[model samples]
Target: MNELSLPTSTEAAIRRVEELGEALKQNFPEYVFPVEHSLHGGMYARTIRMPAGTAAVGTLIRVPTLLIVSGHVRINSGDRVYELQGYHVLEGEINRKQMAWALEDTEITMIFATQAKTVDEAEREFTVEFEQLQNRKKEISA
Candidate 1:
């Protein structure tokens, strides 16, 4: 399978990432991840910045999203693993939870198709995932 098309929503994948996330929390300092949001036309984009050595575990995305990862990182997506750098984009992925470690300061952005006018509305639309990340820095629309 290609980078964009991966086996998702498998129970094993979500569990493995959850374990990684817990390990990261215990090993690293508390980080309030910063996110930037943008909305235009029918798309909503959310960008997150992860400093080197920090890791993040994502919630299952309810909608198909375009993922752009910039900088160096290792991503464990259940049964597969990837080490990516310098602006790579993965698309057509839905219902997946991912675990990523930033080898360098990294930025990950996910774009979704939506009619939401504000960040609040977008969260409301995709409540399942965003609720899991509510502890992060306040959502800032760009």
Candidate 2:
């Protein structure tokens, strides 16, 4: 999908990101003002929780399309971290090592990127699978 096809939902995505930030603040009081950012093509919000030895923990929410990639992490080194197993709207769980940083006591920095191509590919696959299911159902029903 191109920009022109997604103009209306872009505003909704921004609003959702803002609302998500507010919710995180209210829910995770121990975490300081979570860093929130909206780039030209995508939006991201993250909050950091520092609990001594094992670096800081962060919860990140990102809109990479209609697919909302939300997950948590434990930042070990300066720029290295482990993405805790969790859910994204489209990919479900991307449990892997990802990069993150601590800006200060009150904020943590995270990078967000668009997954438009991935989303498109998954949609196409789902469409094909769905058609196959429909045909099977028709044969069985007949």
Candidate 3:
């Protein structure tokens, strides 16, 4: 007879991601959510631009089982570059980065997780949200 072994930490991380994804879908039924994953010890970055003369605000929430290096940038005065914020987080860590900017600007969010398990977990969580969003879109189009 073979004895069953408990899941390692990586498997636990993946399971946590799945749980979070379901929670997001149940809680936020109005907005489209996209989740994505990348390799461990890699970088994740994004930049968004708002229309001229408008202001924008954004938020990022990371779970406690992943490591991340995060930062943001704001463009002001039409050629001046400013670093808005930056920080790092490891497992059992929780942090929030928020920004408000004006005058036709761009903001960027970057994350780097230091383990393959972390990336895989993120990917799983994202897949759940993406599927829900796609279904919503289809309903709207129909």
Candidate 4:
């Protein structure tokens, strides 16, 4: 069997998130609310809480973000799925799309770094349109 490798590009991540969000909505409709807040250091964190057996999907801005899991969750990102329990933190350059399946009553938080002054501004900076990200990616690659 081939290992599922995470997509290396932000464009692929954005596409993956959309696909997963659709599937999750059809299969687990109850766990889709995300509450976001701005923190110091131009950072923002979005939290999603769900009951056991429910799942949720989230998309990220192009910035590197932190993942904080409280309780138990099975996270599926890129081409891989993994489980975490209790309180844990993972930091990395995540794809634009991410999803979590609740193994227990779980709360997952995504922390983003941004310079925006308000929650709305932070959200706008964090969730830039896919087309813009794609264009920026192209410019960077070129």
Per-model lDDT: 0.77, 0.32, 0.35, 0.63
Highest TM-score model number: 1
> TM-scores for all candidates?
0.84, 0.24, 0.31, 0.69
Model 1 scores what on Cα lDDT? Answer: 0.77
Clashes of each: 0, 0, 1, 1
lDDT of 2 by residue, 1-142 (tens): 4221112223344454446445654765432222233343433322233332222222222223333333443322222223433432322112222223233222233334543344333323323332322223344668
By the lDDT metric, which is better: model 2 or model 4?
4
Highest-scoring model, lDDT: 1
Over 1-142, each residue of candidate 3 has an lDDT whose tens digit, in order, gives 1121111224344454445545655764433223343454444322333333333322223332332323443422112223344543323223322223433333233344433355335433333333333333555778
Q: What 10-residue stretch in candidate 2 is worst by lDDT?
A: 90-99
lDDT computed for candidate 4: 0.63
| Backbone clashes in model 1, listed as residue pairs | none
Q: Is candidate 2 or candidate 4 better by TM-score?
A: 4
| Model 1 bad stretches (over 4 Å) | 1-6, 134-142
Quote the positional error of residue 82 for candidate 4 in Å: 0.8
How big is the RMSD of model 1? Answer: 3.3
Model 3 weakest lDDT span, ten residues long: 1-10
Q: What is the per-residue lDDT of model 4 for residues 36-142, given as tens digits with 9 covering 90 to 100?
A: 45478767776766788876655454666677789988876566677778987776464356667788888867687777777657656666653333323444668
